[model samples]
Target chain A: DAGITQSPRHKVTETGTPVTLRCHQTENHRYMYWYRQDPGHGLRLIHYSYGVKDTDKGEVSDGYSVSRSKTEDFLLTLESATSSQTSVYFCAISDFGSGGPYEQYFGPGTRLTVT
Target chain B: SQQGEEDPQALSIQEGENATMNCSYKTSINNLQWYRQNSGRGLVHLILIRSNEREKHSGRLRVTLDTSKKSSSLLITASRAADTASYFCATSGEQFYFGTGTSLTVIP
Candidate 1:
């Protein structure tokens, strides 16, 4: 789990409801990422943060937003959950100087089901 | 837009045998990384090979990267049942992209 924690390990929510996933890391890594894994799609990056208050969209950023107000915490928000968004979410951390580029340490995933 | 795609969606091999998986990317990358995930768990970092390096080894795992071909291969020697998992390759450039994965089943 790499000193990283994701809250609400499992959740069941209705479609159209808002949902938020939290990723907290004690490693204080400069880079944080949110990814979703599905049966056939593998893992898709939803968003990433390079530093506090600095964030960027990944390939699958639609319907999701992210915020990094503190160095140790990165939040992913689903403005309105949808059945298509139901999947296992994972959070990962990495520091460019600490290791090499993209030597990520991942947290246990959160299983979300939207009905 | 996944940047990397892993070959052999599923693999089954007996213990003590060897297993190999390959990943091909669409664009140039600074480095390529491999990760393994047990069922119902998050992925764990396995090995990383830089663009400048051609081969890397860690224990029973061997990774080779060919920058010219924009591809990489992960080979596990003397496989064990405990090595059964899904392996994914990720490419890093201006952004990171991950392939679907190859499910490896090491039979005892």
Candidate 2:
């Protein structure tokens, strides 16, 4: 299970409002990722953290930002939620890096609705 | 867009039949991983095949990678109704990119 949890399994917020989704892990993995899944688009990476305080932007990372203050916690924030930003978000953790083929453990996920 | 493309997009087969799905990606990769997602749930890792490895097996799951073609295929043997879900292939390099996914429906 990798002991991963995501806060607010479901959320509904108005457009222009700010929303923050949290991901916590117990394994203290070196890599944490944020991804969004929408119909026809599958999963798109938003942002990822390689370590505490070390993060990088992903393919679809325009409106989102992430922070990893601790090895167990990674946060994703939407400065101003938009209708187009509504989607199911997922968090994943991996113990390895680009050096090898390592599998990732995923959290339950967060479904956000922007109205 | 580094995202890979999954073929067929959807598949259906009777229980006990073998099911296969293919994924194609661009650019080089360090490894390829397959995942399954049940409805309304997070993805579960199924298997991983490194760039140096051609094939790997985990239980009923078999994965093959062809770096020369930048493609990979996943085969599910002796499928069961519980195996019905969305399958995705992700390529890992400097970053990770996921395919659109193939939805498999196993009839009982």
TM-score against native, each model: 0.97, 0.97
Worst-scoring 10-residue span by lDDT in model 1 chain A? A94-103
lDDT (CA) per prediction: 0.92, 0.93
**The 10-residue segment with the lowest total lDDT in model 2 chain A:** A95-104
Judged by whole-model lDDT over C-alpha atoms, candidate 1 comes out at: 0.92
Off by over 4 Å in 2: none
Question: Which 10 consecutive residues of model 2 chain B have the lowest summed lDDT?
Answer: B89-98
Between which residue pairs do clashes occur in model 1?
A: none
CAPRI grade of model 1: medium
Please provide, for model 1 over B39-106, each residue's C-alpha lDDT reduced to its tens digit, 9 standing for 90 to 100: 99988999988888999999999999999999999999999999999999999864678899999999
The prediction achieving the highest lDDT against the true structure is 2
| Candidate 2 collision pairs | none
| Per-residue lDDT over A8-59 for candidate 2, one digit per residue giving the tens place of the 0 to 100 score | 8999999999999999999878899999999999999999988899999998
Point out the worst 10-residue segment of candidate 1 chain B by lDDT. Answer: B90-99
